[model samples]
Target: MDIATIDRRRLIGWGALLPLAALAGCAAGPGGYSLDEGVRRLLTLSTQRAFGRLLQPGGFYEDQLARISPPDAIGAGGPGRLNAIFGAFLRSEAVRRRVSLALNDVAGRAAQRAAPYVLESIRGMFTADAVRTLRGGPQAATDLLHQRIGGHVVEVMVPELAGLLRSDLLSALSAAAAEQTGIDYLELGRTVAEQAADGIFRVIGREEAAIRADPAATRDPVLIALLRR
Candidate 1:
């Protein structure tokens, strides 16, 4: 057979076997444990743990990696003379600290409200490539998940985060800042949501990497089997 014909035959063979391979991967372990189940469990555990940490008071504020800082425009010059004055005002150390605290607080509260939406996204987005994902790099699962659903998570989070920003304890400060700097709070919400999602995924990726490095630490047979090198 010519090269094209040979390639076509190989494609046909793999296509025919794909379903059986998927079924076997899904029902391979003891008690009918499946790659799907293992992946879901891992994702659930990681998400829950990440959210749990974020839900704590000052969680985002206390963690350097997770903390939300003031928007750059607040420090950098904006469109006009009024913006420059407001930027100067906000650049003061004390005022900037308060703004940073407020942002982090809003992020933490938003995270509390966002957990369900995130979990729902995960449930909806996971595909049938669990085996390859598990066998890939430490962040393979997290990378895949974020690739598929990060934008969705951020989209869902923006409005909720905006609402929280409006109602948070620092609402007055946020309002003044928004008004003076000509920064739209809704845009601020989007920024916070994006950073919040980044922190969440960072935690989840760490958990996944740890589990892959030491599958026995999970103490879950399904994960151990599937993630074991």
Candidate 2:
């Protein structure tokens, strides 16, 4: 789809996710459930929820917590001096807004795809480490998740970022910004992608931490039954 089209439908197919926090608490009160089933469902639901928040309209850019900006210029004539010069030439407000929107859109799209892939990764990784991770530090599950999915995230996201850069609006902006600012626009595209991937990982890590901390998760009826007291 064209940049304009994608920008308009910013959240795409996934938005307004079920209030999972409330649901988890409710389900934890009474139910028979297995740890394996609980883990898989929790992993899938939590990841989808994370991505849903991330991809929502103004989700990334609107929130100070998730906002991302273009990487600072680096190299000869780098941030020391060239930064201001580059900024001056690439100063079209419209183009700037469009670029920001487009980058977020690409990131959101990649995140949508990532939700399922991450669930699969979690199933494989969490199964082996479930016991230790549950008893370990608050961030243990998150850390384990990062280790399992870090490489795959970059693999899945960067190329999509590059691919999105080929769109007309982004390509035009990149060329214009490059010519006007004398910065390597291509590298900037990759930087945006890398940052996007980083943002996705960062938020998912937070989700893992939240799940780890939730008392209800520990008290989850299904999970408790699986552990047999």
TM-score per candidate, chains pooled? 0.78, 0.64
Candidate 2 scores a C-alpha RMSD against the true structure in Å of 7.5
Q: How close is candidate 1 to the true structure, as a TM-score?
A: 0.78
Worst 10 residues of 2 by lDDT: 18-27
Give the C-alpha miss distance for residue 102 in model 2, angstroms: 3.4
Candidate 1 residues lying further than 4 Å off, grouped into runs, are: 1-27, 74-78, 167-178
> Would you give me the overall lDDT of model 1?
0.67
- Compose the digit string of candidate 2's lDDT tens values, residues 62-170: 6554565745462235665556655553476776676667667666665655655665575543346455555566555556666767767766666666666557333
TM-score of 2: 0.64
Model 1 Cα lDDT, one tens digit per residue, 1-229: 5433443344334323222122343545435666665666567656665666666778788876678877765322355754565566566898778777888888876665566766655554445677787678888888887877787777777887777776662463555655555555577789899998888788778777877788888786767777766
